[model samples]
Target: MFPKPIEKSSRSTQLTYQALLPVALLLWLAPLIAVALFAIRPSVDFTVGNYWGMPSSFEFFENFAQVFNSSMPRYILNSFMITIPTVIGAVALSAMAGFALGVYKFKANLLLFFMFIAGNFVPFQILMVPVRDLTLDMGLYNTKTGLILFHVAFQTGFCTLFMRNFIKALPFELIEAARVEGIREWQIFWYVVLPLMKPALAALSVLIFTFIWNDYFWAIVLTQGENAQPVTAGITSFNAQFRAMYHLMSAGSLVAALPPVAMFFLMQKHFIAGLTLGAVK
Candidate 1:
């Protein structure tokens, strides 16, 4: 039922595929390439409406230097403060919940799992008003703690679904063997299940890290100014009352994208392993 492989396609089809590949690649990278180009251009280029043309002079180092010297650094730090704690909390809670749901046979187990899955289908926009109100009432509005807690709660539903499916795909014999060996339930989970979940954990961490790091909607919705704003929201600080600094905004965008990219490369092997492990028989 699979489509014919490209290599096995007709000669004309193969030629067309080869010709279109680079064009598609360029189209995909167009925005990113434009951003990178803008980041290196002098601010005068934007003021003179010279966008989409070659820069008159390059200010590569100067632009990035200005970004770092501004409140961008604090925004980066705030992003880390919010994202790291959310990752740890969401993954930890999901792993335990996944194990219980996947390994045990309770009457409401499927119902509970479905609830988690259903939450993922609900758009976050609908919850925005109530969530913001709740944060305000709890005196957490405009605080990093508020953002962290909200992210963890919202992200856990998806994380639990991921972990639960991964755990279910694991061999059940391992748990039975541990139990037969007189191991306690907690010991079995600690020593046996947790070790096997490493690949999934690594993959999930990278995904969640990218999600929270790139989050702009919630960042703007819940926070304002440099004190609690993440890089995504803080990038707008490049705008003045009457003028928008496109060059600096592009530079800040580039800088803000680096951490998650670095994280994926660092965990590349584990991330791939986690995704592909259960795909084969």
Candidate 2:
């Protein structure tokens, strides 16, 4: 509707548009395609100056095996260690906060909501030093819990904004009915509103999964070494260890990027629904 339907365009314009679609897709996916192809290529291919040629040998399994046997698995485990707890903590906290903002009429409700909305857009670096110091003070520095806690707090800001708007858009009569029935506040939130938030939850879960998975800066600032480093940080180490080993590096990159990509594909319906929840209004 925004651009007008293609059938409304001239025939020559339609032909040009159709022809450009594949080219645009290829351009967009070129980096990912190269990485996937390189992941299956033999290590020697880099040394032989055949970066773009057909693989002399497909060593996908071998490379995958090597990565698994190395610190990659540990990196993955650390990634999960940070990602899952953050997802639960952020989503849970935001659900409560969002419900409060959406349903209540406190003096500072709008102000607090705007604070969250604003905080969500701030650069992570701005909070890096204080967050790191707080982690150190709590004796959680360089630990998975520290990273998880920070992620949970920081991510809650955005999730609360998203969920608040989403919850606000729902019918209020249901809430009024629940209140008339003498439902306690918390029970109303838990029973009446939470069930209707499945789409928002799914979308936020996938989105937060991708955010935490691809996180690198906080991983570096909060944790120092392999003891707590996630895969995104670990990939930098892998790059250093495997100089000129593009095949292995590409493989590691793909592996590191897989979970979030898989999550996007699987939860795409809910993701789109949540994103577009308030766009129409």
Top of the candidates by lDDT = 2
The candidate that wins on TM-score is 2
Clashing pairs in 1: none
Q: Cα RMSD (Å) between model 1 and the true structure?
A: 3.0
| Candidate 2 residue lDDT tens string, 166-238 | 8998999999999999999999999999999988898888788888899999999999778899999998898
For model 2, the stretches where C-alpha displacement exceeds 4 angstroms are: 2-4, 7-19, 274-277
Q: How many pairs of residues collide in model 2?
A: 0
C-alpha local distance difference test of each model: 0.87, 0.90
Question: On a 0 to 1 TM-score scale, where does candidate 2 land against the true structure?
Answer: 0.92
Identify the runs in model 1 with alpha carbons over 4 angstroms from their true place: 1-19, 240-242, 268-281
